[model samples]
Target: MQGKRSNQIVQNTAFLYFRMLLSMGIGLYASRIVLEVLGVEDFGVFNVVGGVVSMLTFLNNSLSSASQRFLTFELGKNNIMELSKVFNISVSIHLAIAGLVVLLAETVGLWFLYHKLSIPPERFDAALWVYHFCVLTAFFGILQAPYIAMIISREEMSLFAYISILETVLRLLIVYLLKVIMFDKLSLYGILTFSVSFFIFLLYWQLCRKRFVETRIKHFIWDRKRYIQILSFSGWVLNGNLAVVGYTQGVNILLNIFFGPAVNAARGIAFQLQNAVNNFSYNFQKAMNPQITKSYASGDMGLMHRLVFVSSKVTFFLTLIPCIPILIETNFFLEKWLGKFPDHTISFVRISVLITIISALSYSMIVSIHSTGTIKKFQLWEANILLMIVPISYFLLKKGGTPEVAYWTTLVLMIIAQSARVVIVSKAIDFKLYTYFNEVILRILLGLPLCLILPYWVFVNMNEGWSRLIILVVVVCISVGLSFYFLVCSKSEQRILNKVGFGFVAKFQALISRYSLNK
Candidate 1:
């Protein structure tokens, strides 16, 4: 059973890695094309409009999380009937919610568009087109929660990886179409791409329903009790979602109000880059969420605890390793790739990286809270802490602080919120945050000096582009090799190394095979 579980984990992790590479890779490449195609103004228009939709999507996002959790838990408990009921109830609720959102977008969202948003009169119609299509896309996208939940529950993560790749390829194809057909109509380009995305999501969901028994909608029946249970769990979840969206998208909106669409475009670039980096680590957590939920349901706290710690450690290192280079080379990267420096994007990336490092450590605790159904109390505390950002951010900006100040303020709020959450969970679970920190955090803290020193040496010693490239390669090799040896590789690591044919047993096996009598 242990070996089987280990294999399952490796398979899941491999799927997540591929998915992250494909999705984030496409995003990074396509962002350059998109900026060139749309130019600054329209690109800003699209992001500003999309940010509004993101705020609304927050309501359904957390609810979808609830759907995934309940589905995984029921499957783990071997309660097929309850799982079916959850499926139907969740779908029914989402359909209702999606309808209401469309109605609100048409009415309230429209009013805010003309009045609250800082759009030039010339761009109004184009922005409206983008907004309408975004609303439609979101409506259709929300209905796939049950199918997505089913896939996660069954641990068919490779399917998700394929879907991410397919979606990205389709979006790139849309970009090509924009070049040929739409020309400079960035609004229409956004609308067309969103329409295409909706169709792709629906197609995947339909395929899952047809292929998997657990996904068949016919097996599901509406149950009021199930509806109540999901909603009750999701209510506190909604508070956290609202708080997060308020601070994140709300900050974008605030930027639009204070500055203009151009500034929002700069903010968009920084956010997309931050999101791309974050998704690299987040994909692992997302893939493990179902397994974590299942383990919690089945009373396997030991495995759950092990997964939690491993996730924290691996996520930290993965995020930290790439971030050093990104931090050091931010201006060079932006200028080289985007043809110009996006305003405030560099500072936003810097402060946001700090926020991500703090938040990544807290994800393990958050997972424990979600799995054990002890998230209710923490939700309120977390939400309150997040809410403090709004007033503090406003006051700082009003006092003439730049975007950098706002970014740091936001980061501090996130750290405080995450720390409060860890404390709450520690009280409930009787496991200190320091337990994981003492083991993993030191590697990150100590290795970071090497991360910085190597990169700084490369940047300083290399003047020419080719020389810089060579120096970067050398520095990366030496830095990572030394860091792994001193910071991460240990006896326990050796045991895993043996399993993967890299340790003493592996060397012994290779020697025996080389000198075997069969030869």
Candidate 2:
């Protein structure tokens, strides 16, 4: 059973990385094109205005979490009947949430965008267009939440990969159109992107209906008891998501007030980089998330514990591989990629990447806590710690702190929050704190410093230019690889790696033999 689960994780990870590489390549190129076309002012306008709408998406994120936990938990127990009911319930809740978000967007978010945000008056109409499409995009995302969760829970990662590729292609297509389209480029990008979103939503809906009976939206399967239970779970999730919205959008708003829209544009670009780097970890997490939930559901604490710790270390390394080099080359990379927008872009990217690494430490723990379905205390305290970033950032900004102070504050606060997450999850599962610290946290600390010494030395010595970047990449890869293999991976993991190595070699030889025979 463990082997089968491992195979499933391998398959999902392989598919996800395939999706990530293709999408990430196109996304990076498209981002450059979009930045050039939109220019700084318009880009910043779109980012800050869109942030208002994003603030209302807290419920969407929360409910997505709520629905996925329930659906995946039901599937783990092999309760298809309950799964279908959960699907219906999730749909009803999401649609209602979508409506609520729309209402909030139209009234509160709209007012905040126009009156509160530091937007220039001339581009107001363009901002309005962007806001309309952003709300449309939000609704599509809300409605499609369950299908995405359903696909992942079913472990149909390849299918998800195909859909992701389609989305990526559409995004690339939008970038192409931005150059050719005669209308207002900003508004056109907004409307066309939302059109793509609408198309993707319909595609997911059709796919889910055909593939899963649970998604069919049959006769009213409403149960007040179950509804209350889901609400009870999702309510705390709402608080947590609100915290995310508060720190993210709230900080954006504060920055707009303090620094203006150009700074927001820089932050937007930084977030794009953040997404690209974090994908390496999150995609891996997505593959293992269901297994964590399913194991806990089946009372397989041993597997759950292993998944938790191993995923923490592995996901951290995944982020580290790309991040350390980027951190070292932030100025060159950002200047090369985005062509100098504002003051804080490089600092933002560096700190954001570093924060992503810190956040990776707690990703699996968040999954473990959520899987246990006992997230009230966890989410409450975590949210409190997380939400404090906004006020702390605000206080600093008001005191004339640099924009880097915002992210520095975020990193420090998140480390605290993430530590809290580990504590909560460990206690929830009654996992050994000493074992986690020794096997996961200490192992990573031991490996990383030793690993960085050689890489950082090489980076410091290398002359400027492509040679330096190439050498940095090689040094980072080799140092991290050897350090992780020797110090981080468990004996079981070492065995697994060796088996996989030999298995691949054997398969390659057999394929060569068969080809020769055919010849």
Candidate 3:
């Protein structure tokens, strides 16, 4: 079972890596095209508008998490029939929620456009169109919540990866179509892209139906008790989502309101870079999620604990490795890929990366805590901090008089939230926060010195041109390689190396078998 699990992890990791590469490739090209085509103000306007509407997705996304947790837990118990019931129940709930979100979007969305954000009158129509299309996409996505969770529970990562790649490719295709056609109706572009994504989600839903017997929606009615339970879970989740909304989308909107679209463009670039770097770690977490759920359900506390620790370390380093180049070559990479923009983008990217790294580490712990039933406690504290984020951010952005101030407020808030969660996790899971800090947190600390060195070296020596990009990449590779060798690797890793042995061992065995067959 251990060997099988190891092999499965290896396979899933490979698939995830492939998916990230594809997604990043699309991101690189798409960022360049969008930046060039839309210009800073329009691009920023789109982001601000989209960010506002995106808050509506909070409940759907949060509920999907609950669904994933329940589905994977059932799968862990090998309760196939119950898994189907959970799927149906989750889908039923999600549909109802999506309907509510759509109705809100149609009625309240326009008022949000005119009053809440900083979109200029000339750009309002364009922004509104983008928001409308995004609303439709969100609706489609929320409705497919159970299908996505089912795929994760089954560990059918390849299907998810393929679907994701197709989605990115389709999005890219839509961008190119908009560029070539040069459509005056910019909203139509938003509509087209989202409609395609919706169709793809439908395809995934159909595939889920064919693949999982448990995915069938029978004549199931919602139990008042279960409905209330789900709603109660979603209510807390809605608060958490609101916090996320405030921290992420709220910050963007605030930036737009105070700083204008140009600064928002810079923020957008920084955010894209943050999101891209985030995808690297996301791949591993997604792969391990089902395993974590299964381990917890079976009361395999030892394995579950081990998996949590290992995942944190691996994800930490995986993200840390690439961020070095990003920090070093932020301007060159941005200018080279997406052309020049506001001056503060590089700083924003660097600061945001630091915050994202810390948050991502704490998030791993959160995922582990989530496997247990103690989510509400964590959620409550996180929500409080999250709620604080908005007022604090608004004051910070308004008073500190810089875009970076907004990020600083966010960083401080995330740190407090993460620290509080550490305490919560320690009490709930009996996992020592100091041990996690010593192991995972210390590696990050050691890595920071190295990450700092590359940028300093690049700034001193290399200036401009492709060599800068090359040098940055090389330094990042060497630094990360050395850091892991010294800080992360252990005797266990070396033993695995020895078990795999030299590449020639398998080749030699094959050769001997061939000779015997011929003789």
Candidate 4:
């Protein structure tokens, strides 16, 4: 059973990585084209306006987390009936949340957008169009949450990957159309983007209905106990999600107010790179998340702990592989990717990479805490720590701090938040903080320097060009790969790697010999 689970994880991770690679490639290209078509000011307007709607979608995020946890826990117990019930209830809750979002977005979100945002007077109308489309996109996304949760809980990663690829391709097509079609590029982009989202939602809805019995709602479930359970979990989750939204989107609004749309454009470009790089770790974490939840639900604390520990280390290494190259070659990459990106783009990308590295280590721990379904205290602490970023950033920007100060603030707060998570997780699951520090943090600290030394040295000595970039990437990969194998991985993990490597070579040789004999 353990071997089977491990194989499944490997297979799912492969599918997700395929999806990430294609999506990231196409997404980076599409973003470059969009920037060229829309120009910086319009791009900034879209980012900030869309961010306002995303702020309210934190409600959707909170409930999405709850839905996945409950569904996965029930599936782990093989409670088919309860799984269906949970899905229906989750659908109900998401519907309510979706309506609430529409209300908040129109009244409060709209008012704030018009009154508080720093858009040019000419672009105000375009921003409003973007806001409405974003609301529609969020509405569809909220309604689609339960089906997505069901797919993920069941570990239907191949289908998830397929849908994600389709979505990315559609968005790419939308960007292409933005260039050809000639009606208010900003407004048209917003509408086309929403169309892609709505179409993707329908795909998920139909796929879940056809594939999973749990998704076929025969009747509305009004389980008071289940409602209380999910809502209780999500309520605390809401606090953490709110803080995340506040720091991210809220800070984007602040940048717009303080530094104007051009700066917001820079931040947007930075985040595009951040997302591209971070997807390496995020895909792995997504593949591991279901296993963590299922293991805990089956009361396999030992297995769960091992998964969390190994995954935390692996996530950091995965993030570091791409991050190291980009961190060293930010300006080169940005100039090549976006011919004329906004100011501060390089600083934002560098700082965002650092932030992503710290945050990557927390994914497995967060999943483990959610699996236990006792996130009240955990979420409270994380929320309080992360929530500090926005106000502190506001104060700094008000006191004439530059735009990068906001990202620096986020980096510091992220460190504090991750530390608090480790401490809380230690108590909640009886996780040994000493073991975590020694096995994960300590090893990373030692190995990271080794990973960077060669790459940085090559970067500094070499001139800036495509050849240098290629060599730097190769050097970083080799350096990080060796450090991960020798310094980060435990003896048991090394043995597994050796076994897998030998097995693959043996299989290849046997296949070749058999084919030669037949010939």
Candidate 5:
């Protein structure tokens, strides 16, 4: 059973990584085209305005998290009937949340877009178009969440990957249309973007209805007891999700107020790159998260602890690989990719990459805590720590700090927040803090210097070009691989790696020999 579970994880990770590669390639290219088509100011306008809509969707995030946890937890217990009820309840709750969001967005969000953000007089109309479209997009996205959660909890990662690829291709087509279409580009972009969301939502809804019996909502469920239970869990999660929205979208608004639309363009580009790179860790975590939750639900505390430890270390290493080259060669990559990026884009990308590496370490801990369903103290303290970024960033920008100061503040607060999670998770799960430190943190510290040394040296010694970038990436891969094998990996893990490595080589040899015989 353990072996089967491990194989499932490996297979799912492979599917997700394939999805990530194609999606990342198309996404990076699509972003370049969008920037070229929109230009910096209009791009910034869309980013900040769209950010307002995102801020209002925090409830959706909260509910989505709760739904995933409960669905997966029920599956762990082999409770099929309860799973169906949970799915129905989740769908009903999301519909209500969707209506609430629309109300809030049209009222509070629209007002903020008009009065609070720093848009030019002429572009305000376009920004307003973007705002309304964004709200519509968020509406569909909210409705889509329960289906997505159902798919994930079912471990239908292949379907998830295929749907994701389809969405990316559709978005890429939108970029192409933006380039050729002669309509008001910004407004047209907004309309097309919402169209994509609505279409994707339909796809998920239909797929889930066909694929899973639980997702066929025969009628809306209003189980008052279950409603309170799910809402009570989501209420605490709402605090953490709000803090996330505050630091991310809230800080975007602050940037608009302080530095205007051009700076927002820079920050937006940075995040596009960050999101692409973040998939390296996120895909891995997605594959592991269900297992973590299910294990806890099944009372397999040992397996749950092992998954958390392995996932935490592995996510950090996965994140660090791309980050090293990107940090060292941000200018080269950005210049090559964007051709004419806005001011502060390079600095923002570099700092955001560092922030991603730090944040990667906490994904496992977050999932583990959620799995236990005792997140009130965890969420409360974590929210307090993360929520500090907005006010501190506001004070700094008010005192004339540079645009990058917001990102820097985020980086620092992220570190503090991750430390807080370690402590909270320790208490919540009776996780051994010292064991985590010795196994995960200490090994990371030891292995990181080795991973950086070769990449930085190659980067400094060589001239900047495709050749240099290729060499730097190769050197970093080799460095990180060796360091992880020699230092970071446990003896048992090393043996497993050896087995996989040798097995691959043997398969390659056999394939080559068969090809030679055929020739």
Candidate 6:
């Protein structure tokens, strides 16, 4: 059973990796094209305005996890009937939430976009147009949640990856369309983004309605109890999600008020690079999350503990891979990737990457806590900690601190929040705090010294050029690989890595042998 779970994780990760690569390629390309076409101020305008409306996403994200957890839990029990009920109730809740959001977006969200945001007077109309369609995109995305959650709960990663690739292709098309269309580029981009979102949601809907037995709308049955259960679970989940919104959208607003749209442009560039780097670990986590949840449902605390620890370690390495080179050469990377940098972009990217590293360690732990379905104290404390970023940064900037002050605030808060995560999760599970610190956290800390040596050497010796960039990447690759292999990984992990390597080679040899024999 353990081996089967491991194989499933491996297969899921294999699919997600393909998704990541396609997304990275298409995302990097699309961003460059979009940035160039929209120019600096307009690009910033889109991000900031869109960001305000995105605050509505706090509900969307919270319910996604709530829905996926209940669905996966029911499937683990082999209760298809209950699963269908859960699906219907989740959709009902989401539809209700979507309506509420539209009401708010038209009233409160619209007012904030116009009155509170620091959008330029000239581009106000473009920003307003973007806001209207973004509301549509956000609404449809919420309604699309149950199908997406169902797909993920079934561990149908290939379907998920394929849908993502399609979305990537559509985004590429949008960028292409952005160039030739004679209308306002910003508004066109906004409308096209909504159209793409709606189309993708339809694709998910069609696939789920056909494939998943529980997705038949005609047979769907709703339950008030199930609604209450999911609501009870999600209500506690709301604090953490709202804090995330505050931490992100709130900070973006603060930046706009203080530093103007050009600063927001810089921030937009930083987030693109950050998200690109973050997608590596995110893909791995997506593959592992279901297993983590399922193990708990099966009363296998032992397997749950092991999966959480192993996943945390592997994904930390996944993040460190790209982060090392980028941190070593931020200016060079941004200048090459985007061909232009706004103010504070370099510092923002660096700080955000560092925060992502700390956050990666706590991700599996958080999933474990969620699986237990008792997270009120955990969410409240963590949310408060994260919520500090906005006001802290606000005060700092008011005192004349740099824009980087916000992310620095985030970095400090994340460290505190992560430590709190381990503590909170410890009370709910059998996790040994000492073991976590000794086994997982210690390895990462020990690896840092080794990881930094070569990158620092390259930084001091090399000049700013393509040659330097290439050499820096090579050095980071070699050093990080060696450190993770010799320093971070256990003997068992190293053996697993070796076996996978040898197995692939052996398969290739067997294939070649058969071909030669046929000849």
Top lDDT model: 4
User: Mind giving the per-residue lDDT tens digits that candidate 5 earns over 247-328?
Assistant: 7889888988988899999999998889888997789899999999999998989889888988998899889888998999
lDDT of 1 at 397: 84
Question: If scored against the real structure, what TM-score would every candidate get?
Answer: 0.92, 0.97, 0.92, 0.97, 0.97, 0.96
Judge candidate 2 at residue 474 and give its lDDT. Answer: 89
TM-score of 4: 0.97
Q: State each candidate's clash count.
A: 0, 0, 0, 0, 0, 0
Q: Report lDDT (Cα) of residue 387, candidate 1.
A: 76
Q: What's the lDDT for all of these models?
A: 0.77, 0.88, 0.78, 0.92, 0.91, 0.87
Candidates 4 and 6 compared: the better one by TM-score is 4
Give the better candidate number (2 or 3) by TM-score: 2
Candidate with better lDDT, 4 vs 6: 4
lDDT string for model 4 (1-519, tens) is 765676678778889999999999999999999999999999999999999999999988999999999999999999999999999999999999999999999999999997899899998898899999999999999999999999999999999999999999999999889989979999999999999999999999999999998899988989999999999999999999989897789889899999899999998988878888889888989999999999899999888888999899989999998999898888889889889888889899999999999989889878989999999999999999899999999999999999999999999999999999999998888878899999899999989898999999998899999999999989988999999999989999888667655655776799999999999
Q: Show the lowest summed lDDT stretch of 10 residues, model 2.
A: 496-505
Off by over 4 Å in 1: 464-490, 497-519
lDDT score, candidate 6, position 491 = 90
Residues 203-225 of candidate 1 have per-residue lDDT tens digits of 87778878776566764475777
Cα RMSD to the true fold for all candidates: 3.8, 1.6, 3.4, 1.9, 2.0, 1.9
Query: In model 1, how large is the Cα lDDT of residue 139?
Result: 85
TM-score computed on alpha carbons, candidate 6: 0.96
Which consecutive 10 residues in model 6 have the weakest lDDT in total?
A: 1-10
C-alpha RMSD in Å of predicted model 1 compared with the true structure? 3.8
Score candidate 3 by TM-score against the native.
0.92
